[model samples]
Target chain A: QQPVQSPQAVILREGEDAVINCSSSKALYSVHWYRQKHGEAPVFLMILLKGGEQKGHDKISASFNEKKQQSSLYLTASQLSYSGTYFCGTEPGDYKLSFGAGTTVTVRA
Target chain B: NAGVTQTPKFRILKIGQSMTLQCAQDMNHNYMYWYRQDPGMGLKLIYYSVGAGITDKGEVPNGYNVSRSTTEDFPLRLELAAPSQTSVYFCASRGTGGSGEYYEQYFGPGTRLTVT
Candidate 1:
């Protein structure tokens, strides 16, 4: 099943912060976050495996809540380059990864 | 590294026509996947391969076929194109065996197909 993303779209200014949430109806083995700029392929951001783990990149961090079957991505002090569509892919089993509807984010100067 | 590469970035097809979307990866990953994205919808898996000559059906496998002849290639075949099949297709690959950890997947630019 496809996961659901909250805040379908959001606009933020530089130095501001935002969060994107993903929820799945089924239990997830892992959650992967990716960002895709207009007319470009999706780029990997971070992944949170089961066991309630958290991972972070420079200013981006993600946490997976196994019990809730959900994950949240945090962007601190957003930059213009952060503008893109963010997708959270969920893995229910061992082999397949299914993506969410996606959240569109626009960071302005 | 080229990561993953897909051919024919864009194509327009007439009804009843057939075509194949080619996906290749240089990372030598053991797992490969094919997905289709429709407007306002999340990507749906079409097919996947765990290794050479090992293929399996995914969520949305009907109207599509796939083959894994080698570790580097997994191709998706559309036997008879239909308007419903118009969407962007992406190919991805990931490494295997990380203690149930999620390995980052490398995705291709994607192929945009429009069936008229």
Candidate 2:
């Protein structure tokens, strides 16, 4: 099943911070985060395996709570380049990923 | 090296028509995937391949087909296109066990198809 993402859209000023959450209905082995710019492919941000782990990429980071089947993406000190859509993919040990609907983040100057 | 490449960046198909979207990867990954994204929506997996000659259906597999005849190419086929199928398609690839494995997937440029 597809995961559910909260905050369909968010607007932020430069240096602001925001969080996007993704929840899965089933147990997940891993969670993957990606960012997509307009008319572009999604770029891999980070991946968090089970065990309630947390991973970070530059100013962006993520935490996965396998117990709750939830993951959160954190955008810290947002930059204009951070404006785009964020998607979280849930893998249920089948090697196939089910993606969330996505969260649109707009960072203004 | 080109990580992943997709053909026919944009296409318009009339209802009932058929077409094929080509995807290729130079990363020599063993896993490839096909997904469709409607405007303002997240991607929906249509099909995926574990390796050459091995394929499986994804979440939204109806109205589409795929083939993984070689490790480098996986193409998606759409038959009897409908307006509901209009969306942007993306192809992705990942290594098997070593390196990135399934930890990360490299995506293609994507093919936008509109069925009217």
Q: For all the models shown, what interface RMSD does each have? A: 1.1, 0.6
TM-score of each model's chain B:
0.96, 0.95
Kindly list the per-residue Cα lDDT of model 2 for residues A21-42, writing each as its tens digit.
9999999989999999999999
How much lDDT does each candidate structure score?
0.91, 0.93
Candidate 2 residues B17-113, lDDT tens each?
9999999999889899999999999999999999999999988999999999999999999999999999999999987685434568889999999
Give the per-residue lDDT of model 1 (tens digit) for B26-71: 9989999998988766778899999999999999999999999999
Each candidate's root-mean-square deviation in Å?
A: 1.3, 1.5
Number of clashes found in candidate 2: 0
* Poorly placed runs, candidate 2 (over 4 Å): B98-101
Docking class of 1: high
Candidate 1, which segments miss by more than 4 Å at Cα?
Answer: none
